[model samples]
Target: MHQNPGGLSAAEIHTERKEQQRRRRNSLLLVVPILLFLFFAFVAPISSMLHRSIYNPTLVELIPDTINALSSWDRTGTPKPETLRTFSIELQQLAKQRESGRLASAVNRSYPGATSLINATARKLRNVDPNQLAQTGHLALLDTDPRWSETKLWQAIDRLGAKYRIDNYLTALDLERDAQGNIQKRQSSNIYIDLYSKTLSMSLIITLLCIALGYPVAYCLAHAPARIAGVLLVMVLLPFWTSFLVRTTAWIALLQTNGVINSVLQSVGIIHQPLELLYTPLATILAMTHILLPFMILPLYSVMKGIDPSHVKAALSLGSPPFSAFVRVYLPQTVPGLSAGSLLVFITAVGYYIIPALVGGTEGQMISNIIAYHMQQSNNWGLASALGSLLLAVIVILYWLYDRLVGASNLKLS
Candidate 1:
């Protein structure tokens, strides 16, 4: 029973250390479920999105022979005779396997008419002799679909050879390659950049609106008596009890032309006709600001509550003017809450989908709406993933900037 420095027996000390280690292990085990959930729910999807945004192997895997053959051909126009021969041969094989539709879909994503052309030709070439397809590949392909002679279709086929490329990302940014292979702005369609700009602008507007609206409410709550503050806090959080869809649709009902607001305004003789409100950017901004206002207020109230009133009181008692004391003393102390609330509201607004989709019409559509369109409607998953990845990149950059500029340690929750 040898005793160590603190007069405890060696065995007791060992048992205490073992108990501490067991506690640490238990704590880690308790967090394991959350760590696993985050990995599966958040990390895995984002990792897949980042990967899929660039890597697409559908065409390369489907038509390996053609992809290999087209390796050396200059993409000025259609490929060489042998490359077309290889592609024609692969088309017959794919048609035999009933996988030509997949090829058509993959190609049609880059070049629209390829679906009709490829499917039709694959059907025509399905029964063609494989040996003859190998011999007169270009002729057979060209004969089946005269459109095969088109340079654009051939260029699209040439592009599929790169199993991993940023072509989708480039397209997401409203850019495409020229005939000479230099990336340039897409002349045919340029909607994404504008939508991205609108998204950021709308999010900023929502954040500012939240600050404007939330700051005063938070100040009141922080300064009020505990009994009154509890009632005020409940009022602030009352919105959370309502369904999100209900809240959003409530805005729709209020903003729509024959709705309560318009009817009330008309009754009050404010205007002859109902002002156009629904389906506009203003509708989205207002709804988002309202929905996110609580997020702003909570952080602000939390920070402002902890701040010592004496600091402002002392500044005032020292003969400082009220405005000057507030600006120089109290406002500086509230930076933590302001930064926390602004970042929270802005991030949430930036990624917001449901409210905007329901309230935001064409005029108010954000980048998220377009991303959803590409994913759900057009099924351009690659483009959607690229857009999402780019958005994620932007958000990460913004978050890093915020953290660098404002210091993440002071965000009220802590």
Candidate 2:
């Protein structure tokens, strides 16, 4: 009931403050669910994957006493008597716990043939008396397997004993630590580096192809009459309406040696024999381009629709050639769309798994296929996580470069 000098009552001011607080509370309530969903669904999984890339605990947990003993021995010399005794006792306990396989599997990641040796030793130790093992020490272990005397096997065990390591990442990059602990290129044939290079190159080629094919379609859609433009836009987006798997399958059917495309070509007398099209890198590129073409077209169409045709006309009216007017005036205006579409297509193409895996035979497989192989077939989660993390890092770096060169704020989409 109290009136202020400005003619508003104190009650009115209190009501305004209460209304503002209520609105803020409602806004926060709406956002809380989305934030929780992101943390649990997206953020948490990525954090766990990144952590797995560096963390490994199977060996250390399975043979703690042995790891403790190895900590004291100089990796350069042969194992001491006490260290050997500790390793023997731990190996017996690990076998009794049925965990020798886990240890062997972990070791096999670094030294290929060590799994069989470790398993064999565990089997041999199962028959020997623990008391005899304690008494005989290093000699008993050597009788079980001469490889136990090898420094390299011990070195592999020592490496896995660490709870966290960079070995996964190093291996993903086709590099490893030598016996001297020096970082060096792996002795094995390098596959990861080549796969990474191929991934990048293919992504680049796909992005360029999408841009080349999408631009004309977008331009036509943007400039046509309203009814015509709507029809054209629908045609551009028709592929997206279909199932992705169906589209990929259709491409395989069309590109197969005796499939629709080859049949049409032969019917037209283009060739006597069918050309090998399916399961090739060219098929991968073509299918990916088709799958991603709409992404490019939508952004380009959105930008072109907003552009005033009069600007290009004004440039032409000033005596500039038509091509020159377009290059200098219209093309520059569409750059934001071009950049957004290219980045979207490139990033998506780099992570492509299904298309490349199904269409791309051995010669066309990408890094994502390798990651899947390690995860599912090899059961090498650490290596898979490392490859995924490296791919994520590459994407982040590319995004940072794009943002620096062409402001992310400039990106537009329909």
Per-model TM-score on C-alpha atoms: 0.91, 0.93
Put down candidate 2 lDDT per residue, 261-295, tens digits, no spaces.
Answer: 99999999999999998888898899999999999
* Reference-based TM-score, model 1: 0.91
Model 1 residue 207 distance off true place after TM-score fit, in angstroms? 0.4
Winner by lDDT: 2
Q: CA shift at 48, candidate 2, in angstroms?
A: 0.5
Cα lDDT tens digits for candidate 1, 218-334: 999999999999999999999999998889999999999998899999999998999899999999998999899999999999989999999999999999999999998888788
TM-score of 2: 0.93
Alpha-carbon error at 306 in model 2, in Å? 1.0
Local distance difference test scores for all models: 0.89, 0.90
State each model's C-alpha RMSD to the native.
2.8, 2.7
